[model samples]
Target: MTTDTELKKEIAYNIRAALPKATSYEDYRKLVLALAESGDTTGDKTVSYINYTLLNNRRMKRWDKTLKITDEQMKGIKAFSGKVIWLVLTESWCGDAAHTIPAMNKIAELNPGIDLKILQRDEHPKLMDHFLTNGARSIPKLIMLDANSLEVKGEWGPRPAVAGKMVAHYKKEHGKLTAEFREELQNWYNKDKGQETFNELITLLALENVGNSANL
Candidate 1:
């Protein structure tokens, strides 16, 4: 039987192997846009997934255009001096990834110490397994690592705190997330304007503070 520590070591090994093949956020965005334009998707290229890819392309564009970070948040982002890589697992058709990844890119943009990388979830099943949320392969999972050491520092994912809570409560009540609830979640993401995601990411960075004393 694999102990937790051994499992983590194995996962880290897998992460190292996957990193070289990971795409930059810019490249991932380009791929997504091309797929949307060509009526295709990254994984399990079903018609519905293709449609979702198309829809998510527009969502990402909107987020890229409209997502705003407050000055304080920017300060928090800039205070971090430790070099790190944010390896994100995602698929083009994931609605949450569409909304949150752009915000992540914006955060990475503000800090030279941070490098953001993307991996297609289906393409890296073994890597995805280690970061599974609730025994399921929930995506847009950000795995933060020490760039030099490749040590896992922390993670943030699938949804923001509030959104995760909402999902949990809804799932508890209904046993599954419905299409209507998904629509509601998208509306929530739109109204929130990526603020929730930004705030949580700022918190994650603070928690991983190496020697930085800056308060968020």
Candidate 2:
């Protein structure tokens, strides 16, 4: 059996391999928009997936336009000096990715040192396996890597803390999320205005201590 260290090394190797293929936030947006136009999705091309892709495309556009980072959050993001790559795993049909990735892009825009790369989860199963949330494949998972060494420094994902709790509570109560609940979650995301996601990301950066450490 593989030890934890060995698994980490293997994950790092997979990340390096996947990095070259990952798209910039701009390119990923273009891809998603094109898919929306073409009635297609990244993974299984079913009607439901296609419809979701279309909806997410619209959702992402709204987020990209309206999501705001507070002055304090801006300062926190700008202070991160370490050269790091935020490799995100996601897909076109994922609603959570639609809500959160634009916020991530906005944060990445504040720091030149933070390179954000987006990859399709299905395309990089090995890398995705390492960052699974609760043993389940969750999209929009952010894997923070040391730019020079490719070491995994930190991670954040799927949903913000409050949203995660909401999901867990709903799941515990209903055993699954209903369409109505999913709509409620989206409404919550809209009301929150990406503040929670931005706050959590800033916390992750502070915890990583990347602001104080120089890139080697």
Candidate 3:
């Protein structure tokens, strides 16, 4: 069970190592939002390819091999009384799903107290529809929820456009998610000028220049 600081440190290292040109928090935030939209809808490959090109380095891929779960470390997260639940709603064939699930697993391994569940969007149409519309239920929905209240703490994706729209819409309609983690991401977005953030936003969606919401 790595401490939140340790986990955040590692995630930050991965973000930096990704060498995303995103310099400010908003720049980075939008970059991720765009990538998610393109990846989910058009099977956009630009951002995904860049991710592979960058983080797929031999050393970085090694991070995957080193990821592990230990009972003791898991127990250390007992202080997370927030009833953390990671809801991964995705498809087996999704490229974005492939990228995200591994990251989710890494996070889960690091935080043992979080309850994680993997659900296929097609199989759980009802759950998928809750956040989607117009027959556009996308894949790779990553939602961190509070089980006791059955409320979402933070959520990301249906992969690309709808996913980004969903978050913004959710914030607009219901108000923003208040989790500290989401705020940290917001901090990353606000720290830089807008360009780096835009590119990184696309990269996070896994489509980059491959395609965009227009195709959907």
Candidate 4:
């Protein structure tokens, strides 16, 4: 098996090569709209053919609203002093990416220490492969890296843990994600209001800080 150091070097080199293909959150939104306009679709599921386009469009609007950051979340974000690069792997057609990216963008915007960059997952297969969730290439993976050292501090992705569990439960019980199931997932997101996502990411960052200190 490859060591973490070797893996980071490889991922860093690949990111450098693929960085040019990355876009800003706003650009990603534009791309999603462009594809929707052109009737392009994504994902492996057959239903994705019809739903990806509509969901992407809907997510764009969902992300446009101001995400409320709790006082505790704000404190945690502000306390981090390290300069880090938040490299996010995603695609415009990914419904999950559409829903998750905006809140992440808002969080990054809150801290000057964090610089967020959006990279298309398909365009950077090597890096995306390194962070696959359950051997699958999940979208909207936020990889935190030391700004100067370029070492990966930590990662969080695809969806909040609570949502991930919900997905797992649904998959186990229903066997597959249907159109109705997808709607149910969206309803969960609506009720959660991105709180779980924010809390999870903040926890990851805090752990990264602890790891950094341990190494020192």
- Give the RMSD in angstroms, all C-alphas superposed, for model 2: 1.6
Number of the top-ranking candidate, with lDDT as the measure: 1
- Per-candidate Cα lDDT values, in order, are 0.92, 0.91, 0.45, 0.78
Which pairs clash in the backbone of model 4? none
lDDT of 4 by residue, 66-105 (tens): 5789999999888776688888997666767767787788
lDDT of 4 at 87: 87
As for lDDT, the candidate ahead, 3 or 4, is: 4
Encode model 1's per-residue lDDT on 1-216: one tens digit a residue. 999999988998999899999999899989999999999999998998999999999999888888889999989998887788999999999999999999999999999999999999998999999888999999899999989889888999999989899999999999999999999999999899999999999888888884345533
Name the lDDT value of residue 15 in candidate 4: 66
Q: For model 2, what is the alpha-carbon lDDT of residue 176?
A: 99
Error of 2 at 209 (Å): 2.8
Candidate 4 global lDDT: 0.78
Clashing residue pairs in candidate 2 are none
CA shift of 199, model 1, Å: 0.8
Candidate 2 Cα misplacement greater than 4 A, ranges: 210-216
Candidate 1 regions exceeding 4 Å error are: 210-216
Which 10 consecutive residues of model 3 have the lowest summed lDDT? 19-28
**Rank order (by TM-score, best first):** 2, 1, 4, 3
Candidate numbers, best lDDT first, in rank order = 1, 2, 4, 3
**Candidate 4: regions farther than 4 A off:** 1-6, 41-51, 211-216
Against the hidden true structure, what lDDT does model 1 obtain?
Answer: 0.92
